[model samples]
Target: MADIAQTRAAPLRHSTAGALAGLSLAMLVSSLGTSIANVALPTLSAAFAASFPAVQWVVLAYLLAITALIVSVGRLGDVVGRRLLLIAGLTLFSAASFAAALAPSLAMLIAARAVQGLGAAVMMALTIALVGETVPKQRTGSAMGLLGTMSAIGTALGPSLGGVLIAALGWRSIFLINAALGAVALLAAWRFLPGDKGSGIDRAEAKGAARFDMLGTLLLAATLAAYALAMTMGRGHFGGLNMALLGGAIVGAALFVVAEAKVASPLVKLALLLRDPVLAPSLAMNALVSTVMMATLVVGPFFLSRALGLGDAATGAVMSIGPVVSAFCGIIAGRVVDRLGAAAMIMAGLVLMVAGCVALAVLPGVFGVVGYVAAIILLTPGYQLFQAANNTAVMADVDSSERGVVSGMLSLSRNLGLVTGTAVMGAVFAFAVGTKDVATAAPVAVAGGMVFTFAAATGLVALAVAIAVAGRRGRIA
Candidate 1:
């Protein structure tokens, strides 16, 4: 078997710049799609003459599909080839975008968006995997930082871009624009990315590709779908259905564990997740930090608009401060991680997040926009630093043949964090405000809720710090 040292010496097929550009473009487009659709919700509701709950399915469907399929798709990329999977994914995404733009009914549009989500999942799972393959070990941190920056930019621009496009060219224009951008990304990927023929996976593993664990894949998909449904709908009506779905998720998880242990080729490597010291802790930190980051993103806009008396434009501007800081800080973090190693950066990031959350919780009203901006400055850079360093650490010990599945695992952790954070934080905010409808709540109520929710979020970040510290102690012992 080829060892980590041997794999590290494997020559990349493309220049670092070329590979980074191709992969970063893919990352940007996928990340952009996640939030771009949000701005069009009102427009879509009007166009479909659908209720708000029904229209929300357009977004929910996409997120659910991506979350459910990302792991399976990443595993597939490992067996087949990441390059091939990425090309196929980009093509599918573009085609879906076009279909969505042309859809005459809400149902069709939702279906198209779901397909688009599948494509995005493929891209998301492979973005870091491909980067790991293409860049040398010494430069992996910087490359990850670049990818992180692109994601920040994409997310930061999504709402503003969507609003502009919707006003100027209508809601369909958003998808249409994505279709065009996707086409360009596809071409660049094809032209720049290395072919699958000599990609990083070991020859022996490729030979065993036919032994793919279909049952494990299905179980994982079912688990993720059930969990996502439970979380998304649990806060609303249908308590009975939510309970059933949660129960199904628990069953699916147990069955998946059994199936993985027996399968010749498991969809996810149970040992890596459960026993590998390095990977286990890194993944845990990833999920926890992601939760903190996501919670802030979910709650930030509400605080700005309600508590700060900002309009849409000002709220957007204030909200963008984090991503903008992240863009520059991500680059710096990459280099820092490469020099100082991932552990220090990860610890520093968690500390910053804890401090930032505390500041936001305590100082929001006292310092006003300055406090919000200050908190964001700390939080965004902390997130970027943690992500770049943690990703490097996770992939550092993974075998080349296992990069695909491991990458999938990493992406899955992030998706889980995002969903969990959004649900939990929103619930906390709703509870604090004493109403499910926060948007309609009084400004004073919203301000109070913001403080309480941010304080709760601070506790979550503190927990992440504890986990990181425990992981470090375990490693030292």
Candidate 2:
């Protein structure tokens, strides 16, 4: 009997391992799609004989597609079947990658990328939702952390990998590599991931759920796209077009809320979603924390190059440290969350973020590179802790039917925060430097800008900590 039991359990263990590997690859491919093309932009420009702005569309198209369609696709998975949708998405991504690699014109390449982004939106949303099904309850945090680590690795590896591939086989090789990876990810997902048992959603679990909320999805997608465009246009300068788009986004948001309220089956359950103490605060804090984190990405390069007088290579090296640290810390943070519980770890992470922000604000100016590295070491680990715990808290108890939509919302919040940071934080830095062109600014001015931007970031993280504390108190009450 003991031998039989051990033999019986062996396949389950292998299945679990294979499932996790599939999910990790899904995350890695989606994130790699985001960062890999960025490094090849210049090469693409020269190849196509296009201006910088035109080539910029290659990246923007993918981002816009994901931002606009992610939530809809997630809700669609809930209505249809996550397993089926994920398989289709992976196939689409792989095919699109191949198309992108063979494109002879810039427009075709951009179109292919948009299609790829649609596929990625599905992968990103469903990957989180499927995690609940794949792992035991006790190991959820560890799984979430592992996913986080893969995301970090994809992000960190993209530029270096893209550079090597572009140099050896040309810019088209980047997309080819993604195509190969996507094919493997698709196979793993198909073979290892649990199949949908007659449409994935249980009728009892999804009471009152009707057909997919097409109207609400459309309204929300348009609003998000407008907002994304408003944030990104004019190269960080808010122009008349940006203002108009921003106004449109605000109006569209109001329409979406009203539409969702009236719809029998809404894309999002606004009341229940907002009312959940853990979920609401986690989403809010995720946005705030992501905004703060993006500040480092946007401001660090300029500060290192201008203020610290580092060359391009040295600046790149210093900037790579944050992602490298995040990649390693993700699993550790997850295990800690599992041990200490999500609630406690969330607060602990916030506290560390506050300290890290403060350190970034002060230490870099005084101690230079050493101080910057120290601040990053503190900040990156804190982010990993918060991410793992927050994701665990949100998804741990989510209803089976609602998981996909909720996961999409989580990704949406983080993306919005990143977009906001790029525009708002960049402006703040420029204003602090007292110049539009930061490259020409004096070292002292650049350093002052760095200090000012990080000072604001510190306050932002402190605010997040306060929010976390209040949420915990309310939960206890």
Candidate 3:
């Protein structure tokens, strides 16, 4: 009788765990689609006879729409109901994927991709918010670990899977595959995932959110768009207007930040990050690391294929090693952090990333895929370690009421950093190469980008080290 009672009680303890797992699966599907499309871009470009600027929009459209919408959509879920948003997002994403798969022109494809981005924003919002709510405070680290592992796998598999599909069918197959997975996720979420009606929504969740900040959204969107365009257009050497737009982006972003700080129920809690104990270091470190990692991901594929003279299949295969290793190592990083504390893990991970970037930057141009693959494997472990630990640290410091906002801010930092990193690094590499043949120009481009990454990694590690040294004790997972 006692044993049976304990067994039954176990479910009560982990009721939210199952929901988290379902949410994790949803993240994997969406993230995989993002990267998988990258590997297929060259093939799509060839087939469409698309210009370089136009081909790039396939990615930019998704990034722009997703980044702009994440905070608004996520906070809305907290205000309304997470489950409602989840269902709506899945439906819209599925429809968009179908259209993307059948897109007859680049313009139509960009539109479809934007719709897909909107859906992705919802999924991103829900996944972390669900973990924060469902998992007990003590077990949140492990829950986040599990979520991070799945997302890492999706990131790694996307390129390789896309390569196979593109080779077997055509570029259309990549988008179609996403549609199929979205369908699967929709079914799974509907069946296995519990309703968020009485879950993930608390008294403090986005109270008084009816007054959405329209002007703030517009200014921020314009800034983000203009900035992204500046970076992308600068690749071929910028016109005067592009530079002017870049300057405007700087001004717009400043205005939005100031506006957000003063508004009642601001669109983003820019002030909270300043006032909160947990968020300052955690968010800063996460944002810095994210910028480096995202830039690496964007440029690494192009470098692997072009610099080392590898093909799509081989490049994807090599890229898979990092995420595959991350899946395994992430577990260990989580456990180590739980026992030894996050500061150590943060330092170690940052060190590894610096080393990895330096190696890739300095590696001989002729080392081929082996050296490239090895460097990425080193990079992934650091990324996963930081991701899990950072989330744990941030959530540990804040009250439960603040988790939704914190998660949204954390995710926004990551997405915006990634979008910026990729665009900037990619354009830098493109400029370095100067339209020379990939074989001749790629080495220089890769070196320049990796140098930037190495510098960024060093700067991030310096911040983590400083924080570690400055404090006596902090909330640890």
TM-score leader: 2
Residue 449 in model 1: shift from native, Å?
2.8
lDDT score, candidate 1: 0.84
Q: Best candidate per lDDT, number?
A: 2
Compute the lDDT of residue 30 as modeled in candidate 1.
89
What is the descending TM-score order?
2, 1, 3
Per-prediction TM-score to the true structure, in the order listed: 0.92, 0.96, 0.81
Provide the lowest-lDDT 10-residue window in model 2. 197-206
The whole-model lDDT of each prediction reads 0.84, 0.91, 0.70
Q: Which stretches of candidate 3 lie over 4 Å from their true place?
A: 1-17, 46-49, 192-194, 197-210, 236-241, 298-317, 358-375, 397-401, 423-456, 467-477
Q: Which lDDT tens digits does candidate 1 get at residues 1-477?
A: 579887766544456577678899888998899889988999999998998888888888889988999889988887778888999999999999999999999999999999999999998999889987678899889988898998888888888899999999999999998899888889878777876666434642565655667898889999999999987874443478888999999999999999899887778778767867678777777777777777677778777888788998898788778878987888899998999998888888888888888888877778998988887887788888889988988888787667777888888888898887777778788899888777788888888888898788778777877877888888888
Compared to the true structure, candidate 1 yields what TM-score?
A: 0.92
**How well is each residue in 1-477 modelled by candidate 3, as lDDT tens digits?**
999988864422334645666687778876886777777678768878987667877877876776777777776666656666776788788889899999998889889999998888788767787676566676766776777887787888887788788889888888888788888777666655555544333443445455656677677777877776775565545689788988999999899999887777676777666756567777666767777776566667777766666687777667667678887777677776677666676667777776776666655343656666667777778777778777777667654444555676777777766655655555555555565343456566655655555555556556665664444255442
For each candidate, C-alpha RMSD in Å? 4.7, 3.6, 5.5
